[model samples]
Target: MRQALERRRAAKAAQHLPHADLADVLAPSAVPEAPVREKGRRERPEPIPSRRGVAKPFSGRAPRIPNLPAFRSSTGQVQGLYPWLYGKSLPPVGAYMGVDCLTGGAFSCHPVEWLHRGLTSNPNLLITGVPGSGKSATIKGLALRLLTYGVKTFVLGDIKNEYAKVARALGVEPVELGPGLPTRLNPLDSGPLGQHLPTDPIELRDRLAEIHRRRITLLSSLLEVRLDRKLDPTEEAALAYAIKDISGEHDGNSQLVDPTIPDVWAVLRDPHPVMVEELRADSVKELRERIRPAADALGNMVQGSLSGLFDGPTTVRLDFNAPIQTVNLERMKGRGDETVAMTLACASNWGQTAIDDPNGPVRLVIRDELWRAMRIPAMVRKLDADLRLSRSNGTIEVLSTHRLSDFEAVGAAGSEEVAIAKGLISSCDVRICLAQDTAPLAMTRDAIGLTDTECQHIASWTGQHKGRGIWKIGRSSSHVVQMMLTPIEQELTWTNERMSL
Candidate 1:
């Protein structure tokens, strides 16, 4: 017992010294609890201690939340209380994506809220910012995400070549609209685009007008073929008389008795035997009372009330995708020079046809650089008010512009750049910034109204951050998503041949 007791004493004294304390380490004993930080007179964390006190810093321990995992198993309730998070990274989306120029990646705002406000609720959205403010990319980015939801897309590549890239990537053919060859896309064909056009009276009138114009143009062109020459005013009048003759043939196809009209000379010589026969002078008189002015007059009214028609999924594609700079608007005449006529007619016709097709896909209408078309008086506000309700019935539109002032022409405010800046951004639910100076776009450190931390990050941003953008999905600005990286080089395509966009 004496030897054992002495041995135990020696082990106790040498406990922390090499192997001397090995056997004594197994002894069961009460552990004294470490000091816990008690709340001070102030509940908030204390200010950083002075240099010397840094080591002791108030409580030589971190707050409960910081040391939580080490102290105990995670509380499921606490985990549940916080929002959904993917991993240990600063942000999950960023882990997958590295933005253009900033170490700061995508943010995770409330998606449900933004989705409710931007897509599910408000059908009309006006996105305005200075030229190159990333507006076009923003639209494409939003559409890219929406496509995952199985939404159909129709873009009127008016100016920039971006939307076409998105469409091509998704498998939509590129169609160019011209004098005798305007492409008519039915919602039945694609499901959604059809319902957009025929939404209102103005839209209806526009549709009928386009059809009428096509019919008239076809007749006129047929007359020219028959005549083998460009018809002069007198020849045109004679051709009209000739068409009237063709329309008069009862239960029979067009076989002209007198195809002497200059425009009809070609058909007279080499008639597509089944060619629609011309209406004679006498019969044409009565038909003129009905169909004569329908094309021109209806086409004119569509221009006047354009904004009132853009409410839903209706669309008006500007000629931005064409050889734009070569297009001399001044030299254009009759219906050819009139873009508003086209918008009105297209919207009216599509809406009238698709409104009742229950199984039809959602409607999508695209208008690129709309300002050029809206310049003719009343078209601006027509788009804004009409576009609001378009999406509920699966109607959507892509409206693009290079100048922010263009929004004023459409009613967001005025041609002033400031009108675009004041606050419309909240409505730009899925905002994107592609390769543009944030300062010009009202997204500078001081512009977005950020908290101190965000401000600190923004101050450090630079231009290599091209394609780094913002995306808000729901109605009340709910979900904010941060995209760390986008496949920028992959989006590159070889198509901008036009100079105007």
Candidate 2:
């Protein structure tokens, strides 16, 4: 009993002892602290040990790395190496169009504005697409938007009267031309150019000569379009003599009298003795025979299906002060291409008067269905001249067509006319191509010099939405633009009212 009591006392004493700290209880064998080095001394880290079964990689000297020299080049040269390096945003100027779908940025463009800003080489633009692709709306939108910048629009030939509403919206009634229509355009009128002549004899003579030359050229072009053949040397000489004689008679009068086509017709019908001598003809009868074909071509304009249109002096005067002017040719739609082409030629000549005036306002000349004019080589030359003179006239020439094939359709595959037509396409720096069918895509691609990628994108836009097009500016800048319009624009530009019915 005494021994058991002693053992219990010992166990109680052990239980009452103080508890040891966690650090003291879990402490391992002691490790020596690292030695401190002197201020100037160097110390290296110890090497790591290898695993028992692992093999090490080769520890030889590393192969020498190449040290290449830096290359230097110009931005232009560098662009060839890295085309994307020059993909900068176009300057924010001119009309505020819409957004560039490719870059998700706003887009705005005007031919003349861009020209003044040095963004484009010329103030000529071409917009083409399949019908119902919103090309018309885009054109109207461009014209309406450009008005804010003080630029005016002149629709040289509105074949289907599509722009009549837009013209009316601008508070101007479009000039309507047809067989029975009272409106008459004198292909001979000197336009505003002949309104006032300078007092100096030299200047007066030059100005009068310019007027006479323009009339002669216009008469010849009209005849060529009607006859579908170029005038021979004799025909051209006789035509010039008749114009000069009429011009001389009119200039001698106390009152200024603008010569009419009837005057020209009468002279051709009866050859003057002086004109006969100038032509070295045997007699008046011989001169008449040489010019019979030319006379007949003019006679057609005087009495043929085009009778009463270009026969008289211009009945309706163009308002140069107006913001927009259009010649409505809707009545000529079913009259056949020959009649339409002749009328367009005459109208274009008449419109040239406005473009010739040095002091006239800068205008946007819209030629819709330009393919009609392209059908005739003479007309092609006339248009080419206008395009070349756009810079001097301070005008923006806008051409809209259904397809590029219209150019190829001008003449035979390799004819001069076809070549000129293609050159016309090349002259336009701003080419806006909307959605197109596969049939025309090949021609469009070749004519526009589009890449395969652009061709694919343009093909995909078909039947997707309206107003989407590839807006190629200058030589390098290109954008996939979605033209946005306001409610008023929607109403004015909508062409489906007939379809809705």
By TM-score, the best candidate is 2
Off-target runs (Cα >4 Å) in candidate 1 are 1-126, 129-133, 157-166, 180-358, 361-366, 376-378, 396-398, 410-463, 470-489, 492-501
Residue 266's lDDT in candidate 2 = 90
lDDT (10s digit) by residue, model 2, range 1-501: 999999999899888856777786688356667877789977787666443322345643334545789999977799678865426557888898888876778888777767777778998999999999999999999999999988899998899788999999999999999878888887777766676777778887787787787788778877887777899999998888787677664345422456678888899999978889988999999999989999988887788857867788888867778999999988888888878888898888888775578887788889999988776677887788888888887788899999988888888899988888889887889999999998999888888888787888888885657999988888877788899999999999988888894
Q: Please, what is the whole-model Cα lDDT of each candidate in the order they appear?
A: 0.38, 0.83
lDDT of 2 at 352: 76
lDDT of 1 at 320: 24
Give the C-alpha lDDT of model 1: 0.38
**Steric clash pairs (candidate 2):** none
Number of clashes found in candidate 2: 0
| CA RMSD per model (angstroms) | 17.0, 12.9
Model 2 lowest lDDT segment of ten: 52-61
TM-score of each: 0.42, 0.81
TM-score of 2: 0.81
